[model samples]
Target: MNTHAQSPDKLAEKILRGVGGPENIESLTHCATRLRFQLHDGGKADQAALDALDGVMGTVPQSGDRLQIVVGGGVANVYSDIMSLPAMRGSGARPPSDAEVKAAMRAKSRGRFAWLDNFFEYLSDSFRPLMGVLLGASLIIAITSVLEAFGLIDTRATDKSSTWVFVDAMWRSVLFFLPIMVAYNASKKLRVDPWLGAAVMAAMMTPNYMSMLGSSSEVPGVSCTTNETLGSEQCVAKVFGLTMQLNDYGGQVFVPLAMVALLALLYRGLQRLIPENVQLVFVPFFSMLIMIPITAFLIGPMGIWAGNGLGSGLAWLNSNAPIVFAILIPMLYPFLVPLGLHWPLNALMLQNISTIGDDFIQGPMGAWNFACFGATAGVLLLSIRHREKEMRQTATGALAAGLFGGVSEPSLYGIHLRFKRIYPRMLVGCLVGGVIVGLLGGVDTEVFAFTSLLTIPVFSPMVTYGIAITAAFFTAMVLVYFSDYRSPEERAQANAERDADERAARDDSAAADVREPLAVGAATAAVGGSGASAGSPVAAGAPAPGEGIVLAAPVAGRVIGLDEVADPFFASRVLGEGVGIEPANGHVVSPVDGELVTAAVTGHSFGIRTKDGVQVLVHIGLDTVQMNGEGFDVRVEPGQQVFVGDLLAEVDLDAVHAAQHSTITLMTVTNTAYLASVEAHTGQDVTVGAPVVIVRR
Candidate 1:
């Protein structure tokens, strides 16, 4: 089972065979740590044999018939070795691009409810690529609003000058043709021919379709009527003896979204029904012929009805319970945006503007946006105060994007999600801003504009809008800044980590001037197994040769080999060779003399890199990240140099049990592959600082 005795080529062969030979491996690419495989049939791969293989650390069978083999720092070399094999040479495919790999990874990390995850992913993919053009159009409208506010032009006068008409067309170009774009994007998301999808939507927006509106009274086949409730005209035309509803398709996002979903099913079915050689011609020919009428007669009307139905509901809520509606929109957005459910609301906003002449949602939505920006601003201030260079940079950029571009994704993903404390504080700000908007009679905007500083003039009752957003911004900023985004222990650990990194950078700079530059592998590999430097050279600070590195028990516990650890990733040594300790008490301390490199804010894990190039990780409680630091009181900060037995954290073992997690504390040499050997001493009761593992380099 131990394939370490085999040569690199032999190891590769074993891996290839373990994954059901070269035939089963549809494609293979490797990241820095793992070999990613697109398999023809995942079930054929031998998980047990792969786990037992000497070179592989572990194997992850992912959703969508994909596989990942953890091979540590030597993944690149192993990938080359696999591809160079005689049987695999002809079977190998070109490596996937970074974006493709990232997308695949995202797919692999689907949530527990597959349908829910897929729904959100579909919506997100359909809208994400169109953001740039949407923003550009939004900014043009913002400029127009500013001009109108200053009385520069009368855009509503129907007798607009040629220059003003051209200006209107500039922004209108994006919104008017939005349906075609949405259809194209949605079709691509569903893996259908995008042009076919675009053509279906374009059919309804053509001049022939528009011509029927003016000829409704004169044309025998066309008839028009007015909707009493919405006060809008509806038209129907007879096509080949069948009555078909005729409606303007411009700016209708929901139609394309629904159409493409059905199209994917029909298109794939058609592919199966038609023969391969003649399929291309027949597929498009039959698809367009079948889809266009179905869309015009059924789907278009249904989609319009669906969008209007949702808009009407929101409209009812806004009118009857203005305060509730104001608060609800902002509150809902925070949860929706992260999962990409916000796009539906965004589509509704556009629909409302097109049908009702203005949208009421953006006014309340501004509360959420400003609150998000405020949270980022708070993080920026704290980073400045604590001298956290990385956080400061991230917060600065996120805040700028939020205020100027009205984009909240950077702040949400970059900072808020990483720290668990920022969201509640941000919600408080959202509530306050929403209440103010409601009491002030709310706000309305004629054009679809992103809720940003530059677009402020687009919203009616501008003074009321300004006051509410400012209140929201400062409230969140004050709350986040004062209470802090991380707990006291996390804050200290972060500062210590920051200090250690700064010191390391200085030392590396000083060492670089005197010594020959280290090999790329030596410089980037090993250390904390997280690609951190191994610290100063042996002569400068490392423990002398033959001395070796002794790792102490980080807590009072019954020591065991990594084989006894519960987690598969740990047991396989993909994170390096070490030991697991079934803790006898809650006290955890440093395992070796080293600089702390990682002190997870959740108080669950720590990474230490020794001056002698030995990297150790102290992980407490299996799956404690789910507990969110509820039971752990971490005391030490990262980057602080520590000797064995220095206190790192205090854990409440009972809380770990209550949270339904294992209480085992694991200490590992995360960079073991880069070392000569790592030996774990197990099967004994040990007090804190008792030697549990040894590293020989």
Candidate 2:
């Protein structure tokens, strides 16, 4: 409702802190219904606490790497909030810095040629939302078909009856009005003027225009006239050699809209040449005159032909190679349903079926429908054994939609995508089902009027329809059950990390009660540095005379001094040298207490000076300069001074691994000979801020 644009980083930050910070989450993902996350520890999550916060609908654990938190219709808003939080500002989260945020936002922005993309994306986003509308209409059509098949509903007599007529009208309205719904969403995505888009869509749906196209016949008395005939004719027509044809540009073809867009641009350009005072008055008048007739005669007819050609091609493919439809439809339907393109094709097919009575919808797509049903059933069955309570519920909902409603969104988003490995299995099941249906000579006697599984009965009595559907569902379930889809090691690692976090949280809580006073004094000492006057021998564990400036490890890892580098690049480095730690195998951490004077041009190396005047060069890995800084996340700005252990950068070990390169952290004092000597810390696996080096003047 608030039309003002929000800063995405700020919004994401807010949501992250609200959800117990980044440390609480193991992983996160999003879908239409909610933000799904896996927590390090469910006990530490505070689900009730999260629900009490604003913007959260509800929280439920669904599956491995699946935690559902309903954020209602404003799910995107909440997602933004989570992404903006400082705690969630991990390697994956885009920073709030102007350049970074803008870059990330640009990726999600509508592109210049995004009309087709928006049309498809909008259709996919709304596919599930429109399920009810589609299902209800289809069910009614199916019921009528069943009744008609059994002689219970008399088509000839009922054609005049109000009841039958009402049913027919309902079916027609749903089909005809679908574009109106699509237009609304498409306009939203394209950021186009909604009223104008809808107006264009409405014009395409006009009864007279639609009727003309459906007939595929020419307008009466509007045939091509020869110049000689016109001259000799009784009425001497002014317009010659033009035939009026019914317009067929009712679907999602882009050419007519493109023409309109081009006309608008041309009109705007032309306005620049008009006299300033009369521009407004003449611009609209002249532009419409040029645009309207040209659009009607040329662009409109061309768009109609394009739309018909697409429809005809699809019909040809299904008719000639129906098995291909059987194979492809089910496989692609799930993937496309999530993005919304499948519906347009379905709409076009239905329209074709209605007009020509033997389009692809009744042939190949019919088999595909059954295959999809099987995939949904398979997902539902596999969900039964899921460990998470929330996931089980979502799975049940998905199954219901797939089994009875014929809606694929629940299964596609909730089940298939979450268990991504199961997707191929679902595809295989659909393929098998399609093959069976095709072998049995299945036919779609009625157009799918609605989107529900209940409507499946309408395609009954075609040999093997029941068997095909059943086999597909069972096969999908069996495949999901037997497959070792999720890795055991990953799950174990997640559990271990969660347990450690819980323990740490508990320890922090317990220590907080007893150490509050001490912590306050330490904070004061750290900020004010006034406690030296207290004469407490610089306090226990405080920096000594020679160690007055403790060199904090810039990164998290096992603390090691410069002497560890075996590469010739740093083997000759001496004491007072800057230190580096291997933070998780190959990640390099900063190794000094000074301002970041420079970031290397390639970003693989950085220079930092110790507080006591030791300049240190910390390079992440040998030949990492060749990496061009791809694995590094720089945190410090130039001229910003850091504490001994403040994080300067985060090196991505995974990325280094992917690149097949070693990540050896190096800390060298570019001016090390200036110091008396440098001593390395005694322990292994030292953390940031551990006394890694002692520099004596």
Candidate 3:
């Protein structure tokens, strides 16, 4: 991947054509790998053309006008390039951010079971935002557990010192106040007043409400019984001639998620029934008055009952057949995420955390995430070997997002879905990882956290979780990397493309030399002959006026297309078309027979104007001009005439390196708009006098 020059500009143009151009793109955003687009009409996109593109791994047309272009790793660059296009210049073509994409994706869960979708989303959204804080709290739990293991603290003591009590409350706060947070988020998700939702849920946890339940001591209209399963006293209050189940909804996630869904329907119906004149005051009053009672009497009890049943079911499976339970979770997730079926399982995770004090689902879920990223790692290795720049970037970004962020959408759509072979290889890693965790007594966590490398410390028996995930990551990485992701035909096609690109670059020097008249040497190769054999070098010559222009590399280095520069300006090709060289030596030379137009006093850049009407800027490194000529020596001034390979400046690369500056010499034709075409020859190394770009007029 590093060997090739990433060129998203041209790739973006191809993607635009395949995607039915800028007009069709209503909105676009990239995650880890794929370019997600919400189009005006998905039917207008050319599937075959997109699939056939050199950089594109594959495509997925989702329900409605949602389309995904699998561009693994380099999607960010491609996105930038697409945004910089002249057609996308207008404000109307500007796409939404990734957050908007996620929000929209959450919104599109529809159909007869739309309420069910909204229900699951309510739970997910409620809990999702709190993950970081919850994970931090979980780590504190882990630390205390570790201390308790060493007898450093009497963790089980009923009476605690002020310091220990404060320490315990740190983690307990997350669980104690969970209902209020869930209520707020769920209400907002359902388009209701969040504060009202919090207020209603808060009533259940109040001292007065708990007091009415009658603890160990007896009270009027209250009764208590021992619950065999929980081994805790269950209490109830008799109100309005009916006994209502009294539950501690402190850490209960399901109750609020479900309760808010019901509240939204009741609230909306009330809005319609009541007249608009007095709606605002009465709507909140009637909705809360009616809904809070229904919640306390019915929904609250039902949610606890459901959570227990689901947790007990999974717990039974985990107890009896741990391997099957573990394997099934990871395997199902791969299929679940794309169709949005995974939300229910995610909800189940929160339920487990709420009722059982932890969730096992996230433990096994790590295997699938690692495996997905592993497949991407495999794709990246191959892209580097065969010089597929776009894929390399796509895979790189997706893998990083996976390992650190615990996200999977990028790898799933970008590489796995596009190349069917990845799924089988990736699943095997998942199975092995799950099997490893299962056989080793299974991994568990005390608090809910995303399964990421950073959260590994939160899992109990850290050794087991570490080994299992490491096995998963390496297993998938090795399988995908060694066996390769592409089919034989696809592999051959990619190899051919790489080989052809290399040959074209090598040929550019000799081809340009042979095509032009040799006034400098008074001799030239056969003008009308067929293409020269491979291994030909640039013959000395003076080009005819109409002959295509040849731009030489200004320094010896590995030549890459402008897309790999990590600067949006160059990667997007706003200046012109060109190549970037990671300079191996320190000297800068003239890349063309041109007159100097300008030269910066800082000595980090240059500008040249050719007799052939090509204006080129040779920028040295990224933001090196900020160095203020500390590491550079300028030899040429403005209006100086120079030929190809003529000395322009001598750079102190050691100084540049010490100063943390890149030495990639970027030579771009600044006036490309007036030309017929400017093509940069990339994916190969070059030296001074070697053809790095071909400008056709």
Candidate 4:
């Protein structure tokens, strides 16, 4: 099925139906080219029907109720459409409960080691929400760096202007308070009281904690020593006779992540042991009392060491194997970002900036960001050349987001991931950029800045950084534009579809001039508004019986070809030409505003007759009659006036699955032969109330 002509909303509705509706969806997520559905019942999905739909590249039925529908390039729009449907209004994905979250962690099998997925997901969720503030802070640092480069301001001056200090605070506030923010998010992810986690981390950052960091003989049981090589001071203070290492926790991410994890365990354990009613008060009190000390004395020092150990290892690698380090970072990021494994490296960058006053990772990482944007630029050029409007729009937006914001997700998910050929081309660009940076003694930034065009000034040896990113951008662009993102066969099909759409558009424009405008008043008079009683048919010179009749989808799901129907009678269009929906849910709605002429007692079928004499039949399953009314709940009576999207029936789809019957719901203009034209839009995922069929007479 080719769904090129369908809108994203229509495509989403059909996809939802194909996956067995929002009720069946345990969770919904999208990546690159596919809509990942965690379904409650995978068996209810009509895989063959979904594969036959337009716009859908394929369907993958995984273990459990996991289903992935490949939409390619425009998966984000499709995902949004599905979630915005009326039936899915409140059923869209939300934060799962603690048990559900645990189950999800257990179910993730993205890698050979399942725990790897959980680890990355945990790290990703903790920092993902902080992106906005981080980007804002990076931009502030970028502005100051630009001023410094241009000699407009001396940022390094000890006696700085108040305005400069204020500007510094704007960026520093985000970085300094970052530990508390990470603690909150990490705690929420672990289903702990986020405030308790934030409070525990905050205790270390208070002025009271900062007062302990000194080598003064006046302060009892406190000592400090300077590391000659590192040129940094280390201090220890006696807390209740236990020696506590005192380190500045500003801009520390690892500490909060570690602290929150242990805190979650303790917090939950307290809940289990304490009385349910009193647990609320006691849980927070006991958790803070216990975790605060543990974190201050143990986790804090360990987290610092862990962060330092990782940063030092990378620093050593950069010092010795600079070339490998440069190439490896840029090349690795493309894969890491998608799977969310890059958070550790990101943590290291922050640690380096906090401790050593500079970070080297972001310099190499700019190569990957530019390469990703470059691939999108290539796709945009190719899309323009081929006149692929959808791809052009997607690519243009993705490229802009990447270049300006240094956010790769839009480019990666919207364009690069959809095309396999682009990755190797993009990687070549990453390698070239990395090589240039390595050969030029590498680049370093004093601030944790995003490697966007605006933040380029933040990196030292700005000329080397510029050259590397420029090379990376153009290299990927040229390679992708010349080679083409799509396979030859795919390109041919796309061109053919483009040609068809153009031809149809021309025909519609030409027809619009000669044909009379739709008789809206006449049609409305006859059919009335949604709930109003239908009046008599219109007279001549008014709209015809079939004219201006738009049949909406009866269920949320993918609309497939009549031939995809398992029932021979329906498949052959013996009753009429129409579309078949692989339902996403069991609640079927009326597809037209008309009188319910026939509502089967078994609830397997319904026939509606519009005031203008247009006839429509909605058949819910193949050979479901033998099972009788065991699974179906009829919602409308024969002769009842109904409007589009009015509930008609609710079928127990699981029962149908057990009966080994197809849950493909069919909608047909049963009197198709008499109509001038009955256009059934198929091969699209659509929501209930989305137009699926149009008739002209």
Best by lDDT: 1
Off by over 4 Å in 2: 1-174, 207-364, 377-427, 438-463, 474-697
Pick the winner on lDDT between candidates 3 and 4.
4
Order the candidate numbers by lDDT, best to worst. Answer: 1, 4, 3, 2
Q: Which candidate is the best by TM-score?
A: 1
Writing each residue's lDDT as its tens digit, candidate 2 over 75-148 gives 54556666655556653332233222222222333346766444434343333344455556655565665566
Question: What value of lDDT does candidate 2 attain over all alpha carbons?
Answer: 0.49
- Ranked by lDDT, the better of candidates 1 and 4 is 1
What is the alpha-carbon lDDT of model 3 when measured against the actual structure?
0.68
User: Over all chains combined, what TM-score does candidate 4 have?
Assistant: 0.51
TM-scores for every predicted model:
0.64, 0.45, 0.42, 0.51
Off by over 4 Å in 4: 1-114, 214-219, 314-320, 328-430, 439-465, 474-697
What is the per-residue lDDT of model 4 for residues 587-691, given as tens digits with 9 covering 90 to 100? 899988887755655577776778766778788887675555569887876657999889999999999999998889887765554567677777778888787
Instruction: Give me the displacement of residue 138 in model 1, in angstroms.
Output: 2.4
* Residue range with the least summed lDDT across 10 consecutive positions in model 4: 524-533
Better of 1 and 4 by TM-score: 1
lDDT scores for all predictions? Answer: 0.74, 0.49, 0.68, 0.72
TM-score, predicted candidate 3 vs. hidden true structure: 0.42
Clash totals, every prediction? 4, 29, 8, 20
